[model samples]
Target: MKSIIKKIFLLLPLVLAWTACNDYPIDEDGLLITTRSECYVSSFELLGTDQRSVIVDVATVDTVAQEIHAEVNFGTDLHALWPQFTLVTDAKLEPKVTGFVDFSDLDNPRQWTVVSGNRKVRKTYTVYLTVQEP
Candidate 1:
């Protein structure tokens, strides 16, 4: 019985080590790594200075064209507005959108790039905002 107990203890580390070895990869976020190449903005939102939505209706996201269009109420301040974007799973955005950004210039749209989780695909998106007529 003592010999059996010693053998069990001796093999326990090996068993644990074997179980620790994994064939699958994990990302920094602890998510299982995948080879998905999909990269696009699924949704877009703009917030006013008061932290309220400035969009007149749902923002339009054109994946094929890689463009986003949003209409804000007339007189809405675009000089300091916050943008929020929802992207495909495991995708990342460049120049990560964090705080307020200037969208007052209608001619020059803002551009952001989306990179796939596997780093296999990249898409640059242009964001356009227009003010509704009072």
Candidate 2:
């Protein structure tokens, strides 16, 4: 009985360490593929305009460290386009905006602008990311 108890105690640490080192595979919804890389843009919104607040719906994949571009068009004709805008995320991250654009040079639509508010906006645009299982 003493030898059996000694053997069990000796094996306990190895068993626990093996279990801790084991990583299980995962399965989730909206998972594109099982790979070491993935990128996407989740949601985008337009805030603070002379007309009204608007949200743009987008669904697409993006590569890591690459810019997730978006084009916003406000259906209002302003004499001089001057509207402050920002992109807010549902995540705990702070709101970010690309440097405001000067659309005064191009006159074609009611309102058309790019997402160049200030700095390079980086956030998990895609919500509920499906990280592929290893």
**TM-score, predicted candidate 1 vs. hidden true structure:** 0.77
Please list all clashing residue pairs in model 2, or write none if there are none. Answer: 39-62, 42-125, 98-116, 98-117, 98-118, 99-116, 99-117, 99-118, 100-117
Off by over 4 Å in 2: 24-54, 57-134
Using all chains and alpha carbons, the TM-scores for the candidates as numbered come to 0.77, 0.25
Q: Please list all clashing residue pairs in model 1, or write none if there are none.
A: none
* Model 2 per-residue lDDT tens digits across residues 1-134: 99999999999999988885554322232212223322223333333345443223432324353233333344433233333323223112223334433333333322322222222333343221111223
lDDT of every predicted structure (CA atoms): 0.89, 0.35
Cα deviation in Å at residue 9, candidate 2? Answer: 2.4
